[model samples]
Target: MATTDDSFNGLTEYCEDCDLETLHEVSVQIRTESTKEENAQFSREPYRVCECQRCGNRSSQRMNNA
Candidate 1:
């Protein structure tokens, strides 16, 4: 299983330590932005966290919704 949230599954990403593309288990985290303004709107930023299945290396990337 790639993730429990079903964001990214069965994907291969670049591993710097492995020096090649390898299969990774991916998980997503949505970070909410907060402002000091009482009426300020909030936005969510999604980040994908990847862990190499072979080498146990972890990496994260920000996702662009636009």
Candidate 2:
């Protein structure tokens, strides 16, 4: 349940500095784009707020759990 470095592990992605596409640190996030039903329920689309752990460059993507 715990990691030594406490760094969040994630899928591979392009990092300008890494070039090898290293891991990213997913941090706090915000959401938008609610569906009609979800809007009524006050739901919001998920988005990941991440940064390249190796370079600190930031990026974002839809938080698709699947």
Candidate 3:
């Protein structure tokens, strides 16, 4: 299950500003979508928000839970 809280550290990704791969602070957040029913049902999709340690650049991408 994906958690509601954010997590940080131990993540590395490419930074455009730095022009290299660097460490990052990563957090996970749930993206919810509602169904067309009267009482809507929500589905959870998780994504990661990453901030580069070197240049402080930030980016986001969808996380595959499979």
Please count the clashing residue pairs in each candidate, in the order shown: 0, 0, 0
What ranking emerges by lDDT with the best candidate at the front?
1, 3, 2
lDDT of 1 by residue, 1-66 (tens): 332433355577678899877778879988665565653356667888888888999877779766
- Superposition-based RMSD of candidate 3 using all C-alpha atoms, in angstroms: 7.2
Q: Which portions of model 3 show Cα errors greater than 4 Å? A: 1-9, 33-43, 64-66
Please tell me which model should have the higher TM-score, number 2 or number 3: 3
Question: Against the unseen true structure, what C-alpha lDDT does each candidate score?
Answer: 0.72, 0.62, 0.68
Can you write out model 2's per-residue Cα lDDT over 1-66, one digit (the tens) per residue? 112333356355667777766676666565655657646455555686767777788877777654
Local accuracy of candidate 3 as per-residue lDDT tens digits, 4-61: 3233554566677997767777788876655656534446677888787788888777
Worst 10 residues of 2 by lDDT: 1-10
Off by over 4 Å in 1: 1-9, 33-43
lDDT of 1: 0.72
What ranking emerges by TM-score with the best candidate at the front?
A: 1, 3, 2
lDDT: worst 10-residue window of model 3: 1-10
